[model samples]
Target: WKSLIRVVVSGAAGMISNHLLFKLASGEVFGPDQPIALRLLGSERSYQALEGVAMELEDSLYPLLREVSIGVNPYDVFEDAEWALLVGAKPRGPGMERAALLDINGQIFAEQGKALNAVASRSVKVMVVGNPCNTNALICLKNAPNIPAKNFHALTRLDENRAKCQLALKAGVFYDKVSNVTIWGNHSTTQVPDFVNAKINGVPVKKVITDTKWLEQEFTERVQKRGGVLIQKWGRSSAASTAVSIVDGIRSLITPTPEGDWFSSGVYTNGNPYGIAEDIVFSMPCRSKGDGDYELVKDVVIDDFLRERLKKTEAELIAEKRCVAHLTGE
Candidate 1:
């Protein structure tokens, strides 16, 4: 048996976790050579559902899955974990204000941050997948003063992957042929998917598609709104695709992509060239080597239009940060 790696997945009983757990158990996220001990954390109210899911996972009898444990408390689940996925949050239901949603998630993440600080292993890496994930990640980072800031990342790879799929479809190229796609700013509607420097088969994407007007109109909007489109088509929110992106994000983190090729992720900005304020969590093209540090991609051309969009998205993130600060009195 391979050595066991403890993986803590918060919000273990939620819809997204339901979709993600099977892949993790089957050794799709972590390599097959590694044994996994899944540590699940959920709210007390969802403990029964988590147990049921654990029972199902047990029946699968995955060779690499050495153990599965469930807990209602974050500290218990985080104990000695090597990786922690902060997937649980206060999801918005019908007729909820943005502020209300952020407030609820901030409280949840604050508590989780303390728990992570207390019990997660010294080298634990965390990825926050909850909605408003960037700021929620910020809350966790601020509270977990013990952990390195770079070790706590938020999920923006989902948006980046969506952009790649859509771009590939439009360019009549295979998805693997596309590279250098970037998702900047927040993870919401305002998130900027930079295709300016992207390529198909190593040729600049602009050379393939000359319709600047159409590029400005359709491509950008489609990538930004793909989640809503998926919801419209499926009559529910995206789970499978989101789960796949999470896997990809983690994989990229563990196995660094080659130089000159990078993926988008929510990373800490010390007010870098992108004009993002100091320490704010925002998505940028980043390269990692599985050591938990993400270096930002710099000097890519940002046209006037792209700059405006980036500003707009950054504004949204700033507003979110302030709103959460107000609620939590931070």
Candidate 2:
């Protein structure tokens, strides 16, 4: 094994983490030679399911899996953790309001924030994957002042992947051939899938495909509501793809960005490319150095269309921050 580090995964019994755990154990996020010590966190009601997951993990007998621990206590689960995948939060059900959902999860993430601040490794990196993740990341980041803001992130890489796939399909190219796709602002429907800067096999996307109608309307809406579209077609929300996106997000953090290409991630607006309000966890085109650190890619072309869309997502995040204003004490 290349290295051994403790990783705490929240919502260990949930669907996303159920797939994520295996990926982590198999060294998909890290490297094949790396061993990981996994600490699974769940709600009290999910303890039995967590145990069954642990049992299956043991049955799989992954060589890179050094050790496994399960608990419902955040304090216990977060202790000595180097990486925390905060995936557990109240999923939005039928007729549920965003404000109500945030309030419920506010308490959960607030407690976790405290536990992470109190006991986790000083360099611990936290990735928020639960719903309302951008704001939820803000809550956790606000609650942990000791850790650097850059240490916390929300998963917008899913949107980035979705945008790349959509563009690739429209361009009649493979997804791997798509690069420089950015998911700007919130991970919600207001997100901007920037095809303006996207490239398919080193050719400018716009130069290759000249359907302005498709790019302006269909591309925008499809990337924004792809999650809902999937649910309508499959009778479920995204799970496997979400899991893959999580792996891509983490890998982007731990691996250096490819030359001339960047990935998108939800990050604090401190010294960002945009002039958006500070303290909003916004997604920006980013380059990583494989050191658990990232730098925003700046000075990209932003026409009126892109600018307007960015503002809308910014406004949505601002309103979301206001809804949880009580939690942030701002």
Candidate 3:
């Protein structure tokens, strides 16, 4: 029998997890030779749904899946976890302001952070997928004083993937032909989908597309707001794509990056070359060596326009940090 890699997933009954759980169990994120023990976390109100989800996992009989446990409390579910996927949070209600949503989720992450610090593996890699994920990840890391902040990540691979797709379609090439697309700053509308550094078919995107106006305006806006566009067309938030991005995000961390290529993730901004604010979770170009470690890609050219866009997203993240100051102890 293969050794078990303990993984804790919060919001286990949500739409995103509905898709993600199967992928994890199928060894799509981790390798086929590795086995995993899933510890599922959910709210008391969602316990039955969580049970049903577990039942389905049991029915599927994935070869790489070894053990499964379900609970409503993070403290109970987080023990010895090597990977924590914080995918659940209260959604923005009809009249709820963004600040209010941050505060509510801030409390949730703060408590979970403490739980993780107390029980999870010291080297656990956490991926925060909850909305306002950049700020939520910051809050989570801040509250977990014992855990290194670098272990926490906000999901921005979706934006990076979106940017690559846009560039591919505009250049009339396949999506895989596009590379080096970096998502800078928070995971919000203000996030910068940096076409300046992206390439198509091993050539700079600007050199191929040749439409400065569309690249600067249409391409960036489309990537940044692609989530909203999907919701508008589908009448529901993106679930399957979001799940796939989570897999991609985690895979990027564990797999060695291709030479001359980098992926985007929301990482701690301290020591970052681009002068993003310290102690905040901001997305940037990153490369990994398949050892569950990554470093920020340095010396990427950030033109004046991209610099200004980065500043806007940084300011928004700073304001969000201040809004959750009480929870984060900022």
Candidate 4:
């Protein structure tokens, strides 16, 4: 029998987690041979909703789902968990400033990070999916001094995926044909999609597409604003795609990255070789060794355009860190 791995997912009752929990339960993440106990954590307002979610999970009868637990307290849900999906955070509503959103979610993530530090396995790998994810991850990592900062990651595969798909469609090739698309700096709108490094079917994207205008202007803007465009069209933020990206981020951390290809993930930059300054969570190309460990893809060429965008996103994350400085205990 495969050893049971406990996975904790916060915001278990939220729209995105609703999709993620089922995927995790079915072994889409850890493999079907791996039995898993899923713990769902929510806040007081969503505790009852979490119960309903648990019931639905029970009805799903997922073969790999050895157990299911739900709670309003992170202390309970985070106990000895080996993997944590920090998915729940307050969404930015009308008139809500970015700083305000970070401040509100800061308290929640602070408590969660402490809880994880208290009870989670020393090897726990955390993937932050909540908005302002890069900084929220920084907050969580700061509070959990026991956990290696490298074990914490923020989701940026979504932007990378968007970039690849855009290139694939324009090139009339399969999505998988486009590879090595790196999303740098942040998960927010200022994210820099490094098209210069991307490849389609082993051919340089620039040669295949031949539309320097689109690559330089349209494609980057679209990838950066993809989430906002989704919200504008759906009247809500992305759920399924976001959930898929969460799974992608987690799987990437646990599965060895393929040769010659790397994925985008936001990671700590305390000693990064990338020109990004230390002491903040920054997104960059990364490769995993299938042990919940990743190495940043070093020596990536950053042109003037990519450099300016990376700097812009870095400033935003630094500002967010300042916004929640009081909560992080840093």
Clashing pairs in 4: none
Q: How does each model score on TM-score?
A: 0.96, 0.98, 0.99, 0.98
Look at candidate 1 and tell me the lDDT of residue 185: 88
By summed lDDT, the worst window of 10 consecutive residues in model 1 runs over 321-330
Candidate 2 lDDT, tens digit per residue, 223-277? 9999999999999888889999999999998998999999999999987756777
User: What are the lDDT scores of the predictions, listed in order?
Assistant: 0.86, 0.90, 0.92, 0.89
Candidate 1 lDDT, 1-330, residue by residue in tens: 667999998888988899899999999888889899998898888889999989999999998889999998887889988899888887688899998899888889988888888988877888999988999989888888888888888899989888888778888988998999889888889999888878778888888878777677888898889888888898877888878888999898888778779988997776577776776788888888765566777867788888889889888988898888853347
| Candidate 3: tens digits of C-alpha lDDT, residues 11-61 | 999999999999999999998999999989999999999999999999999
**Candidate 1 deviates by what RMSD?**
1.5
Extract clashing residue pairs from model 1: none
* Deviation from native of the Cα of residue 159 in model 4, angstroms: 1.1
In terms of lDDT, the poorest run of 10 residues in model 3 is 1-10
Q: Which candidate wins on lDDT?
A: 3
Superposed on all Cα atoms, the candidates' RMSDs to the truth, in angstroms, are 1.5, 1.0, 0.8, 1.0
Question: Best by TM-score, which number?
Answer: 3
lDDT of candidate 1 at residue 102, scale 0 to 100: 93
